[model samples]
Each structure stands twice: as C-alpha cells, then as structure tokens.
Target: MKKVLFASTALIATAGVAAAEVNFSGYGRFGIGYVEDRSETTIVRGPGADGLNGTADDVLARSTAQTDDVILVSRFRLNIDGIAETDGGVRFEGRVRLQADEDASNGEANSAGLNGARFSVIYGGLRVDAGNVAGSFDNLANYYGNEVGLELFAGQYSGVDYNFLAYSSTGSGANAVFFQYSVGDFSFGASYDQAQATVIGAGGTTSTTVDADRWDISATYTFNNITAAVAYGQTDAGVAGVSDPSLTVLTLGGEWGDFSGTLFVADDATQVASTDGTAWGLSAAYNLGAATTLLFTYGDGNASADTQQVAIGAIYDLGGGASLRGGIGRNDCDSCASDTIVADFGAQFNF
Candidate 1:
C-alpha cells in the first residue's frame, strides 16, 4: 500500500510539471462593413488593380445600403509554446501561429495550407530565430486590416483596398534571417531574405524565377512615453529582365495615455523600369474607453498617378474575447472620373 501511494504521488507531480512546462495564448479580430458603392466600377479591387468609377456623392449617399459587410472573419488563432532544458543552463523558446486565409477558406485545396512554424534558441546574450513568420522592420508601422508601407517598394501602390505586395518564403523556397541586440532603452536590428516567385500570367504563361534578395536595418529609441525609429531596405532581383528595386523608409511612432499613432514616408529608388515611385502615410488610434477605440488614416502615392486615401473606424470590445468593428473610407485619384467609399462592420472572437 505504501509503495502504491508513493507511485501515485510521483505520477501526479510529473503531470503537474508537464503542464507547467507548456504555454498557450492567442488573439484575433473579426470585422464587417457596408459600402454604399458596390458597383464594380466604383471599387478598387486590390492593390495594383485599376479602379472603378462612381461619383463621390453617389457613393457616399448610399452609406445605408445595408448589405452583408463581413469584411474579415475566421481571425481565430492558437499557439503552443515550450522551453527545452539544454546544456547552457535553460534555453527559452516558443512557437505560435494560425493558418493563412487561403488555406482556411477552401476545403479542396491544401496547396496553401500551413502558414508557418517558428522556433527560437536563446543562450547567454545571443538568440537565434528560424521559421515562417511575419515581422515589421525599421520604424515603419503596420496598419491592421488596412495597408502596409512596404507594398509601395514592390510597385503595388494602387489606391483601391488594403491589398499590398508582400514577399514570403515557404515550403522548399527561400528563407529569412533576423538579428537583434539591446542595451538600455535603445535597440537595433537587421533582417535579410531571399525567395522565388512563381508567376502565372494570363493565357497560360507560367514562369518560375528567383525572386529578389531583400535587406533591411532599423533602430529605435524610447524616452518616457514616446518611441521613434527609422529603417531602410533594398531588393535585388536575381533574374534578368526583372527590375531590381531599392527602398528607403522613415517612420515615427508614439503613444501617450489614450493616443497612439505612426507616421511613415517611403521612396522607391529602383533604377529598373516600371518600378519607381514614392509614397507616404499616417495612421492613428485612440482609446475611447476600456471597451472602445477609434482609428483614422491617410495615405498617398506618386506611382502610375497621384492617389490619396482617408479612412476612419471604431472598435468596441464585446467581452468574452470578442469585439465589434466598423469603419468608412474613401479613395481618390487625380485623373480618375470617380471616387470610392468603403464601409464595413464585423465581429471577431478568439478562444
């Protein structure tokens, strides 16, 4: 009887240790909205796509159209993390992620399935990370569910929607590496990436070529409630006949009490044909209360034609890891016959 009790206690202790070694957490946002102008010609389809035409008055007049404005959903995510005991004391590590949207939307396609797997190894004063993940370099900021400044560097600055150009390496493709070091309230880092592009043009023209080599470096400083940073990046195409683009970006961001905002300016110094332009953007978010927030943004670009955009939105936390969001936006161009107005509302939850 004594032996059995001792064994049972040992098993319970082992189980508790195992549980304590693992960590889990996640967050997500869902949103929907109604646009007054759903006419194909009045909307900007995606980044780099041509725009549709509808009078600004006509678009704004229909703000109450009341359509299913579900813009973003399935924002749920999960994470599993743990640290391993190694020879150098104890190393710290973790992995967290979610499936890409294309993978979750279609049941028949597994080609775009897994998003990424990230791992980190830390020892002494050095840490190394390897994996498929998303990160922001420099002081350039990311606009959640909106647009990112890096897209302009890739020659994709159309004033339609939030779709911007992105570079990714997955499967048997290229990879990225990042390095960082910190002292006091200042930190600096740099990242490099290389990948291949599988381009399938219209009329059955499919081509596979080495994409581009990209590098970026940035520095940040913090003082009281303000933090500021700047970053520069360059991309060189490995294939002949493709344009090699180099980009420079400056970003300033800060937060105080209920206010947070980022201002960004970027220039594309690509010497290659069909890939040179300049762009800038500003975005701000303010907390209204514990459960509510407001967002505003403005952006412009000098590619193809001069284009500009403005947007405003709000989010309300609904408790239980859920929130309600809605926003209205407009896109205008110098030579276009019409403007676009976009509005949407939706709910997001996390578990």
Candidate 2:
C-alpha cells in the first residue's frame, strides 16, 4: 500500500502538537472462485404419522446436495492514520478503516463505513495500542505465511481458530489492550481482551450479564537469516456450558536469495472435535524471474481422517503496485463424500 499525506492546517491547529501527520492507504482485490464440492441444503415437507396432507402433523427434513459452483469475489479497504509528536519525543497515534466486501450467496451485505478505532502510543521500539487492537497471537511473525488464494485462505493449517482477539473491521471489537517491543532482531508482544453483554428478561425487570475474556503472548527472534516465533493464547468463556479454548503455535521462516520458505505447527483445543489435534504446514515460494514467482503449500491437520491439503500457484507482477495471482488446491475433508477441489484467479492492487 502507498500512503498519501494530509497537509491541512486546520488539523494541525486543532491537534495543538509540535508536529502532526495524517495519511491514507489501503488495497483492493477482485476475482472469480470455483469449488468442486460446494453444497447446499433443501427442506422437504411431508405428511407425518397422521398420513394427511396439509394437516397440522407434518415433518420437515433437510437434505444436502453438491452445487459445484462458481462465484465472484472482491473486497476494498481504506485505512486512515494520524500521528502527533510532542516536543519530548513521545508520539500519539490513531487509526481507523473503511472496508467493503462482495455480497455472495448467503453472504451479508457489507457497505463501506468507518468501523472501530485504535489509539496508540509509540516511543523508540515500544508501542501500546488500545481499542480494536490486534492480539498477540495474530501479530506473531510468519503466523499467516501459509495463506494463499484470492481470499487468502489457509487451507488445512489454520494457525489459531479465532481463540484470540482480532481487529474487527465491521464493528467495535472487544475491549482490548496490547503492547509490543522490538530491539535488534528480537520482538515481544502481549494482549488482553474482554467483552460483556447484558440480556434482559421478558418482563424487563431482570437481567443477566455474560462476560468473555482472552489473552495471548508472543515472541520472535531472528538469527542467521532465519526468524523463529512462538505464540500462546487462551480464552475463558463466562457462560455456563461453554468450553474454554487454547492454542500454542510455533513458526520458522527465512528468505534465501530467490527462495523463501516457512514451517509452522500448532496445538489447538478449540472444541471442534474434527480439528482439535496438532496441525502442521509448510509454504514455499521461488522467484522464477523478475516478474513471476511460483508457490506451493501443504498441510496436515492431524485429525482423525481426511486431514491433508496441497496447493500450487503462481504470482505475476503487473508493476505499479499491482499483481495477478491464482491457485488450485485440494482439501481432504472428512465430511465431504469426495475430495474437494478449490481454485481461484484474481488481481490485486495497493495504493
């Protein structure tokens, strides 16, 4: 993304700071996608034991069938960032985003609008952020290095299953606090988030409050052209009958001339019985020329069955902050009657 600076005298005067700067930047992507095993459910109604049509006793059943469909996908995001520095060298900053996504079948309409805000304080190599903050788990280096496709989906190796807080783009995220420090080739981060909601009784005189809390920590170190990172996170459910989830992950990645590769493993207990074990993945890319790169990725979910995926793709530079990318991948899904095939082609640009 490229940043465009704002030079409004009114903004500087209103901030009353020694120096202030504001900038805008973001990206947009659009593409077509196909799924070989897409499916949908249909409801059928029939007479019950009474054996009478149009009677009160009727049965409804749901049946699923493969759609094997294709669809269009797109997204646009705009980021606005403002910073002000005091004479003492301390800097205060704030950021917000406007984002929109294509409305596909069964997808909700997401119109562009300003979502949540994050405020930060920065000094030297240390920074602190509050409100709509990114959690430590999601901020780990190379955590999402395996992502591919137009939608940037991580096939079988989902690093963490939303067990940690993330910056929300369409709404105010959890009340959160995060901090990070970097020195030389070492960096560390930690975050905590909480959300609560009150439910009112039918009579409006009784109410109950439900609370959820989460926290995570991460550290990264680089040596000899290799970077290693570790992240751990836990979530506590304050509601009855809800199970807590936890995740621990490690990642190692490096760039060697025209070749780059990353390896990651994660142990997660997210209450999803099918994906609860230890999962691992590898992602690699090699530059074929000045304008193209070849990519490959593989992952083993370590589940009871059908727990693997492999994909190959390429990226072509279009120059001027634009590129064309595509990939074809297969997922060994346990629930699918057959292996699922997915493919996508798209163009992306940053400004």
Candidate 3:
C-alpha cells in the first residue's frame, strides 16, 4: 500500500506560504550468502582486441563470474517525497531517494549510497516525472514481483542491459523522463533517457564515446482479480558498427483467494551482432496464516544464453515494521556458462 504523509506544519492558503506534504519511506535487507558462476566468460575488456577484457590478452579486464565472496551483505534505501497543490489544483511532486549504488561491490557505502532525484506533475489520472527516473519496463511482473535468494531468478535483467530502459527506476544510475496516465481500470506509461548507454570504440590507446538515447512504453489492464501488461522499448545505437537494441515483455498476474502469481514472457534484441535473448518467468505467493506467507519464483531464458532458475521462500511478519525472510534457490546460465547456488536468511525492515 502507498503511504501518504502530511508535513510537520499544516499551513495552507496563507500569505505566500505553500501547503506541502512530505513522505519519508524506504526498505532494507541484511543477510549472509555465497554465489558463483563461471560457465561462460564473465569478463569485460577495455582497450582489448577480443572485445572483452580481463582475458589473457587484455590490458584492463573485468568479469562477473565470481567463485566466492564475503557472506555478510546488506541493502538500504530511503525515499523522501514532497507533494503540494497549486491554487488551481495542479499537483506537484518531487522525490529524492537514498538507494544503493548499482555498481558498488559488497559492504560499501561511498557517499552514503545516495542515488539521484526526480519530480513529477500530476493532474487527475495523468502524471509525469523527470530527472533520474526509469522507463516503463521497470513495472513488469518479473521485475517488480517478490523475489528470493537475493534476487537470483529475477532482479537484474541480462538481455537488455545497455540502457536505462533495461534497468528502470530501480536499476541504479540511468536518468530519464517518465510519463503515465490512468483511466478507470487501464493505465499506460512511457519513459525516455538520453545517452543511457555510450558507444565506445578503441582508437589505438584512445577510445571514442558516442551519445545515444532510449525510450519505452507500457500499458496495463486490470479486470476483476487479474492484471495484464505489456511493455516495449528501443535504444538508438549512437555509433557505427552497432545495431539498435529493442525489447518486448508481456505479463499476466492475478489473485485467487490467498494465491497470487505472475507469468511473464520477454524477448530482447540488442545492438550486438547476431545475438538474441528471450525469457519466461513465473512468481507466486500464498498466505499461510495471519503473519506468514510462502513465495516461489522461476525463470528460463533462451537463445545462445540459455538460463534457468528456481527459488522458494517464506516471509514471517514480526510486527513493528520488520519481517523474517528465508529462501533457497539455484540458477545456471549458458552464455556465461556459470551456476549460482544460493541459500539466504535475513530480516527486512520497511518504513
């Protein structure tokens, strides 16, 4: 449920004083875990001939395949929203979030993990946001639904990883403008980001960076106890030797009694030559009692990068703004040719 909060002072319609309400909120989790994957090359190259780094031939290289790491991990987020209405009834809303850094390694707080800010204007069912916002695909079921084992099967998207459209508002760092409108049981949203990904080319010891942009649109319908949504996105390859990237996702979600689940299918094409990505995933939840719930999630990806994952978790409400979380899962990917084995037990706090 969305929370609406009032400002400390309730002054309204006064001399030059605007009536504004501020809402403060966020969620966090902490746990111990281990992960590893090394089926495919996890390396990225800079100034390397193989179009990859960290190999035997690269000057600077990095890879995501990790065999092991520290087990202690934590996440934190904070959001402050300012809202006010003009005398003519136009609504103005601004948000600043203190979220985790997207590229940060484990157990690090550089500059207190501050993300960016965004603002929105709303009139009736229409709303728009600018500055540090994400695209419409962020609201997809597999992206937004309950996830377990530290977001093994869900969470990050691999197919469309080049731009803000792939990450949405939650993906740490891409900034954009977002638009949305709602009428009764139907709603639509769109977003655009300039230079979300930069084209890079090695010029001897020099590298070239080109500017590009991306955009996405999504629509959703709610009927009875079900909601269905579709999102499409495209990214312009700002430089030569690159193909324009595009993605499409379809999702169906519903609740029958205490059982709720989401089924989603996605297809992605990026600027990389001769490469394709397709995925299907499902997530479900059931309440076991007043304060306990069970969750399950699974995902399978096709193409050169065949991947699959499944997880089951349980959440126990502990009252007073906290809950107990536990999950176990396994994931394997072909392109990177790696496997992730996971078991996570933690506590989450919401405000």
Among these predictions, the greatest TM-score belongs to 2
Error of 1 at 283 (Å): 1.6
| lDDT per residue as tens, model 2, 1-351 | 123223354466447665887778999998887777566767677765555444434536778876536877788999988888888888999989999986544233468888789999999999999999889866888776756687764443543344578888868877699999999999999998876656544434455777767889999999998999999887776667878778888999999999999988998777777667787888988999979988888877656552577888888999999999888887765554677677889999999
Residue 213 local lDDT, model 1: 61
Steric clash count of candidate 2: 0
- Model 2 TM-score, all chains together: 0.81
Question: How does each model score on TM-score?
Answer: 0.65, 0.81, 0.79
Candidate 1 clashing pairs, residues 3+ apart or interchain = 30-348, 31-346, 32-344, 32-345, 32-346, 33-69, 33-344, 33-345, 41-52, 41-53
Per-candidate RMSD, Å: 10.3, 6.6, 5.7
lDDT of 3 by residue, 112-154 (tens): 4445677789999999888777678875544555676543334
Ranking by TM-score: 2, 3, 1
What C-alpha lDDT values do all the predictions have?
Answer: 0.53, 0.78, 0.68
TM-score: which is higher, 1 or 2?
2
Clashes of each: 10, 0, 11
**What C-alpha lDDT, on a 0 to 100 scale, does residue 126 get in candidate 1?**
48
**Which ranges of candidate 2 are over 4 A from the true structure?**
1-15, 37-68, 106-109, 159-162, 196-211, 239-243, 304-308
- Model 3, global lDDT: 0.68
